[model samples]
Target chain A: MKLQAAIDRVSLDRANEIAKGLDGIVDIIELGTSLVKDYGFETLKREFVGLNESTLLFDGKTIDEGEYEFEKGFEANADILTVMAGSSIDTLSKTYEVTEKLNKQMFIDLLEVEDDKIKQIANFKNAIYGLHHSKDNKNAFDAVSSVAAFHKQFPDISNIAVAGGIDVDQAKKLSEQGIANIVIVGGKISGADDPVAAAKQFMEVIK
Target chain B: MKLQAAIDRVSLDRANEIAKGLDGIVDIIELGTSLVKDYGFETLKREFVGLNESTLLFDGKTIDEGEYEFEKGFEANADILTVMAGSSIDTLSKTYEVTEKLNKQMFIDLLEVEDDKIKQIANFKNAIYGLHHSKDNKNAFDAVSSVAAFHKQFPDISNIAVAGGIDVDQAKKLSEQGIANIVIVGGKISGADDPVAAAKQFMEVIK
Candidate 1:
């Protein structure tokens, strides 16, 4: 399993510093939606200028205008971009087409998508299916159990990722379960006092 | 019926000029999601410092982290912020609570939300329910018919807003239909050779 570190709700300068510190240490680096919305993609794109090692993912969470958002995301040098699973099938199909045409990747965020909706959108075989929990919800999420259930329900979804408040221990267990292609850790790693040390700990556990 | 002129996919300078020109002419001035993504909310917020007349509606299209996004959106002086109807009941409820506390407005974008989902989310009495057609979708949307069908299905939903490819004739017809409380026009009004004149024409028809 690979580790995806998400940097969120911080200034562009701080985000850049963190990304620089974490370069080559993590598998993928995510510029969270807050950064994209707070600083704008034009500025964020400039911040992402020279990362030699890790792939950059922009969590655009595009719910509509998939083509424009995808094209802009790619132009910003995003190796992967995200779209809401709750978006129209037409929107999902369009983003997937753009991703394929650009020879890049798309992560479909399953934040509030129902099974019926999921059934309709699961045909994007090459896209990474993200089982995500909303950060605003006060309810607790059992990441391991959620992943297991998701795998059981959609066995054909090969490239799967799980996000929302994933910690080092939970990530270790998820790695042992051998289900998700990538385990995304946000505050647990990025919000720590020493994010680099925290990231190292997570990397050790996931490996 | 109110006219909402959405400014999208343009440079910040152009958007600001357009907003300045259309300020009091339109009932609501939407800073489209593309602007928010391309320019960042901080910069966009700064640009919106001195608008005197129309309510500024930022198309945040927030899907997760409802409280944070809502707080940031409102802090930017937006009178109205949008949340995706496809978001979780928890997320939607959280955003509604924030909007209520702040005494601001919330617009729920029902781009691809299902009837079952709408049934669950329809109780936010103060929220303006938006019937939006995805821009990425190639299928044509009959705005008047869609609004009528939506009104028929959810009679309790009083404040309805319809968007997508609305022209002068369609806006006039929708006003004549007397179903929607607001009609949103994007390219037809904002993309016109003379946007201010186009906006005035829409306002005349609606009024």
Candidate 2:
């Protein structure tokens, strides 16, 4: 399993600072939706730089107008962009086509979607299927069990990611489970007093 | 019925020009999701200005982190902001609370959501329930019938809006239907050769 450190709910400068500190430490560094919506692609493109080792993912959470948003996001130098699985099939197809054509990546955020919806959208082989828990729900998300169940349900979906209130222990357990390709940790790492040290703890456990 | 002229997929300067021309003619001026994602809220707040008449609606389409997104969207001078009906009840509650406390408006976009979900979220009586057809779905949308059916299904949802390929004829029919409080027209108005003239056509028919 790989560790993805998610940076969110902070100023652009601060996010950049955190990103730089965790550059080569985490496998993927996510610029959360707050940054995308607050500052936007153009601003993010110009400002968010200097990452050489880790892949950068922008949580675009695009629901419609997939072609335009994906094009802009890719142009803004995003290695991977996200689209909501709840979007129409046409939308999913469009974003996937854009990602494939550009040779980048797409992360399908499965937040608020059912198994039926996931089955319909699961055909995107290259896209990472993310089992996300809503931030506002304040519910406990069992990363290990959730991954095992998701893997069992869809044996074909090999590139899996799980997020929502993930911690170091859960990360370690998920790595032991060996099903999820990426374990995304937000707030715990980004909101910590020392994001670099916090990310290092997660990285050590996941490894 | 009220007319909302949506500005989308155009340069910020062009969008501003069209917005200025349609200011007093339309009841609401929608800075579409395209504008929000492309230019972002900070730039939109700084650049999109000088509108004295129409209510400014930003299509935030916020699925999570409800309070933060809603607070930033409202701070960006949005008199009205949108939240997706597909969001969790917790998210719905947070956005609604913020909107109510701020004495502003919330437009709940019912894109790709089922009747069961609508029933759960329809309690935000002050929020506008927008019956939106996905832009990616090529199927023809009969706005008049959609509004009628939605009204029949959810009678408690009174403050209603409709969007998706609305023309002057549909606008006239929806006004006669007497259910939808607002009709959102995108390409027919903002994408027309003369946006002001197109808006006038819609206003004349609705009246």
Candidate 3:
């Protein structure tokens, strides 16, 4: 299992600083939707200039106009971009095609998506299916149980990822479960007083 | 009925110019999701300084973190902010509460949302329920038919808006049908060679 650290709701300078500090520490570094929506692609594209390692994922959460958003996201130098599973299959297909064409990656954010919807959209084999919990919802998400249930439901979905308030212990549990390809940790890792140390802890546990 | 001209997938300077051009011509000027994602809220907040007459609607498409996105969108000087109807009831409620508290407006974009979902989310009495067709989809969307069907299904939803490939004739028909509170037209006006003339024609027909 790989550990993905998400950086969110912070200034660009702060985000860049954190990204640089966490470079090569985590498998993937996510630029959260807040940063993208707060700073725009132009600023982010320019700010996130060089990184020798760690794939950059821009949590675009594109719900519509998939082609335009995905193209722009890739042009902004994101190695991976995300789209909502709630989007139409056409939108999903378009984003997936764009990602494939660019030889990049796409993460399908399965937040608020029903079973029927997920089944319909599960055909994107190469796409990483992210079982996400909404940030607005106050409900507690048992990451391990959720992943187990999702795996049972969609056994064909090979690349599985789980996100939303995941901590080091949950990461370790998920890693132990050996089902999820990637475990995404947001506030637990990025929001810590020492993000690098926190990332190292998560990395060690996941490994 | 009101006419909303959506500005999308363009540079900020061009968007501002178009917004300035279509200031009082259209009832509402929509800064589409592309703009919000491309230029972002901070740039838009600073750039979209003042409007002469038309209300500004930002397509924030708040799927999660409803409060944060809604508050940020409203603070960006938008008269109306959009939230996805596909979002959870909690998210919808949170955004609606913010809208109510601010005495502003919320437009719920119902794209790819099932009838059951619509039934669940239809209780936001003051919110403008937008019946939107995905641009990514190649399927045909008869705006008038869609509006009529939605009205028939959810008679309780008083404030309704319809979008997707709307033209002057279709706008006239929608105005004649007298169900939708607003008719959203995108490329027909903004993508036209003579945007002002096109907008005037739409306004005249709707009137």
Candidate 4:
């Protein structure tokens, strides 16, 4: 399982510094929605000039105007962009097509989506289906159990990513479970005193 | 009924120019989600100057991290900010609390959400429940009928706003129906050859 470090709610300069520090150390560096909504994509595209080795993912959380958001996100040099699973099927299909045509990736954020909705959108072969827990929920996230249940429900969706307050131990267990392709650690890794050291710890455990 | 002129898919300068143009004419001026994502709330707070009249609505389309997004959005001088109804109940409640505490309005974008979900979230009595059609969904929207049906379904929820390809005739009908509190028009008003003239025409019709 690959480790994806999410950098969120920070200044662009700080985010760039973190990305450069974590370059090639983690599989992916996610510019979380807060960054995108706080600083804007144009800044990310123009000013955020690091990540020589790590892939950059912009969590646009696009719920509508999928084509425009995807195109803009790709133009911002995002290797992957996220669209909400709660978005209309038309929006999902449009974003998937845009991602495929651009040869980039799309991460479908499965936040607050019903099973029926997930089943309908599970056909995007190249897209990574993210099993996300709401940040405001204040609930415990059992990543391993959530992933197992999601796998059982949508066996065809091979590319799975799980997020929501994930820690190093949970990352290790997820790696052992051998189901999720990417284990997204946000505050646990990025919010630590030494993000690089924390990322390294997570990488070691997952490895 | 009120007219909300939405400025979207344009440069920040253009958005400002349009917002300036539509000020005082329309009941509300929406800096659409594209602007919030493209330029950001910080930029909007700093650069988007000159809205001397008309309520400013930032279409944040906030799905999660509700309190943070809402606080930032309101601090950016937005009189109103939007949250996705499809968001977890926890997120919705948190955002509602933030809005209530801050004395700002929250517009719940009911895009692509099932009626059951609507029924659950309808109790946010102060929120303006928006019946929105996804721009990506290539489907026709009957504003008058949709508002009528939604009113019938959620009669207790007084505030209603409708969007998606609304025209002057439909605006007139919605005003006549006396259901929706706001009639949100996008390209029809903002994308017109003469935006002020177009807005005036709609205002005349609704009156």
Candidate 5:
């Protein structure tokens, strides 16, 4: 399992600092949606650099106008961009097409969609299916069981990522489960007082 | 019916000029999702000005982290922000609550959602239920009939807004139908050779 540390709800300078501290130490560095919506692709393209060894994933969370967003995101040098699974099939297909053409990756966020919708969009072989838990919901997330259940439900989707207030222990469990390709840690890693040390801990556990 | 002239897929300078030209002319000036993603709310707050008379609607299309997005969107000086109907009820509720507390407006975009989902989310009385046609979908949108059908299915939803390649003819039809409170004209106006002139034509028809 790979570790993706998400930096969110902070100034670009702070996020960039955190990102630099964790660069290449983690497999992926996610400039979360807050950064994307707050700073945008233009600014991210110019600033927010220093990820030489890690993949840079902009949590664009694009739900419409897929081609435009994906093209713009890639132009900004994003290794991975995200699209909502709840978006229309046309939107999904367009984003997937754009990602494939550009040889980048798209993470399909299964945030608030039904099993039926997921089944319909399960054919995107190259896309990473993200089993995300909503941050707004006041609920506990069992990373291991959720991945197990998702695997049982959609066994064909091999490239899986999971997120939502994930802690280091959960990351270790998920790694042991060996089902998820990427375990995304947000506050537990990026929001820590010492983000680099926290990320190192997750990396060590995952490794 | 109100005329919402959406400015999209254009440079920020161009969008501001267009907004300045149509300040009080149209009921709403929408910095479309493209502008939000490309330039961002911070740049928009600083640069994209000239809406002294009309309501400024930022199509943030927020699907997660409802409170943070809503707060940032409102802080950027948007009179109205948007949330996807496909979002979880928790997200919808949190956004609506924030909007209510701030005394702003939220438009719940009904794009590619099932009727059951629509029925469940129809209770946000103050939210404008936007019947948005996916830009990626290569299908015909009969704006007037779509609004009528939506009204018929969910009579309780009063504040209706419709968008999807709407033209002057359809705007007129929607005005006559008396269901949609707002008719969102995208390319027909914003993409027109003379956007201000096109907006005047739409304003005339809607009036």
Candidate 6:
């Protein structure tokens, strides 16, 4: 399994510093929705956010106006962009087509979506289906069991990612379970006192 | 009934110019989600986005991390901000509480959400439940009929708003319907040859 380090709820300069420090340490670096909404794509572009080794994913969480957001996100040099699975089918289809046409990547955030809805949107073969737990819900998320169930339910959809309060132990367990393609760790890595050391620890465990 | 002129898919300079021109012309001036994601809140703050008369609604479309987005949006001087009804009940609850505490307003965008979900989120009495049609769907929307049906279904929930390809005639009909508190017109008003004239026409008809 690959490791994705998500940096959120921080200043742009701090996020950039963290991203540089974690370059090549993690497979992907995610600039969460707070950064996008607080600072925006044009500013993100102006600030020079290219990584030397790892891919960059901007969590746009697009729900509508897919073409515009995807185009701007890609233009801003995002290797991967995210769209909400809860968006209309047309929106999802448009974003997926944009991602494919641009030869980039798209992550479908399956936060709060029912299985029936997932079944409808599961046909995007190249997209990564993300099993996300809401940040505000003070509930615990079992990454291993959720991945097991999701894989069993949607056997055809292969590229899977799981996030929400993920830690080193859960990352190790998910890696051992051999189901999820990517394990996304947010505050556990980005909020740590020493992000590089924390990322190394997660990388060691996942490997 | 109030008229909200939605400005979208335009440059920030053009948007600012249009907004300044439409200051007192419409009841609400919506800096659409495009503006928020394109230029960002920090840039908007630096530029100064206060209106002379109309309430400014930034379509932040807060899906998760509700409190943070709400706090930032309120600080950015938005008279009202939007949260998706498709969001988790927890997210909706947090955003609503923030809006109440700030004494601002929240508009719940009910795009692509089922009625069962609405039933769970409809208790925020102060929120304006907006019946929105997906822009990418290319489907015809009857704003008047949708409002009538929504009112009939969720009669206890007052303060309704409707948006989707609204024209001057439809605006007149919605005003006659007397169900929606706000009628949002996008390209019909902002994309017109003479936006102030278009806004005036809508205001006359709705009144």
Docking class of 1: high
Off by over 4 Å in 4: none
User: Taking the candidates one at a time, how many backbone clashes does each contain?
Assistant: 1, 0, 0, 0, 0, 0
lDDT of 5 by residue, A31-119 (tens): 99999999889889998865889999999999999999999999998999999999989999999999999899999999998999999
**Per-residue lDDT of model 3, residues B1-207, tens digit only:** 999999887788888888888999999999999989987888888886558899999998989888988888898899999999989889899999999999999999998888999999878888999999899987898999988888899899999999999988899999999999899999998888878888999999895
Note the residue pairs that clash in candidate 5.
none
**lDDT by residue for model 2 (B38-99), tens:** 87888888998658988999997999889999999999999999999888889999999999
For candidate 6, what is the lDDT? 0.94
**Could you tell me which residue pairs clash in candidate 3?**
none
- Candidate 1, A61-179: lDDT as tens digits: 99998999999989998999999998888788899999999999999999887888888888898899999988877789999999999999988888899998888889999999999
Cα lDDT listed for each candidate? 0.90, 0.92, 0.90, 0.92, 0.92, 0.94
Model 5: per-residue Cα lDDT over B102-150, one tens digit each? 9999999998799999999999989999999999988998998888898
Tell me the TM-score of candidate 5's A chain. Answer: 0.98
Docking class of 3: high
In model 3, the Cα lDDT at residue A117 comes to: 90
Stretches of model 5 off by over 4 angstroms after superposition: none
TM-score of model 4 (CA atoms): 0.99
The numbered model that scores best in DockQ is 6
As a whole number from 0 to 100, the lDDT of residue B25 in candidate 2 is: 89
- What is the two-chain DockQ of model 4? 0.89
Clashing pairs in 4: none
Better of 1 and 5 by DockQ: 5
Q: Please give me the DockQ of candidate 1 compared with the native complex.
A: 0.83
Kept native contacts, fraction for each prediction: 0.87, 0.79, 0.84, 0.84, 0.81, 0.86
Candidate 1: regions farther than 4 A off: none
Top candidate on lDDT is: 6
Cα lDDT of model 6 by residue, A1-207, tens digit: 999999999999999999999999999999999999999999999994579999999999999999999999999999999999999999999999999999999999999899999999999999999999999899888989999999999999999999999999999999999989999999999999999999999999886
For residue A195, give model 6's deviation from the true position in Å: 0.9
Name the lDDT value of residue B125 in candidate 6: 88
